[model samples]
Target: MIHNLFIRTICTALLLASAGCRQLDEEGLQTEVTIRLVMPDSRPVTCLEIRDETSGFYNINTYERTAFPTPDTNTATVRLRRGVYTFTVEAEATYDDGTTCLLRCADYNQITQAITWVREQESIVLLLKSVN
Candidate 1:
């Protein structure tokens, strides 16, 4: 009777462990991602958007143009499933001479680019170009 009880307990534990692992796998892994925006002329980001192409999940942020700090001030941290994403940004940069121009994300001659987030935590930087 003791031997049967021991076997049953071990089997029960194994089954529970397997079930938990399967559940975790089915849920997928979550990743924390930080995205930063940069403009060629060091402009303050007025608006930003990040989207997961596959999942259609997106986040947007808009900042007051008169904010003190300029470039590198636009940043966002979000939790997402490990996957690919795209970034969009709009900013108004004022030159020393009081000239202003709009900036948007551009990479390798493309207006938008795909970035992958696979690690538990990741940081990404995207370059913005003048749209005006």
Candidate 2:
């Protein structure tokens, strides 16, 4: 009887210990991005799509436009494949002349931010801007 009771106790202990670990590995392992939108002629724009080159992951947002011609912050959660990434943004904006430049600051600044997600991390914000 004692031997049987000991085996049950050990099994219960193992079960309880397993519960302490995280069940969902992807729970907090999301990449968040924030784009500080700006216009070609210095204006605040909204409704844009952000795409990661290294990873074929993208997110769209309709973040509230900030005060008068300033970059407003937009937040998004992305599932990264675990490594450094170069984020690219495409702002659906048209100038007064009705010309869409796609809104990229510069080729050098193509990689707005680099993130390494070894574990679950909070939302990461990327400032959205365009070439001056």
Candidate 1 clashes: the total is 0
lDDT, residue 46, model 1: 47
Report lDDT (Cα) of residue 79, candidate 1: 70
- Per-residue lDDT of 8 in model 2: 100
Tell me the deviation in Å of residue 22 in model 1.
Answer: 9.9
Model 1 lDDT tens row, 1-132:
999999999999999999999889755676776667666755443443332221122322221111112234466666766665554455555655566676666442222445666788998776767775
Model 1: CA > 4 A from native: 1-28, 43-72, 92-100, 108-113
Over 4 Å off, model 2? 23-39, 50-84, 94-101, 104-132
Q: Which candidate achieves the best lDDT against the true structure? A: 1
What are the per-model numbers of colliding residue pairs?
0, 7
**Global lDDT scores for all candidate models:** 0.55, 0.43
Relative to the unseen true structure, what is the C-alpha lDDT of residue 112 in candidate 2, on a scale of 0 to 100? 54
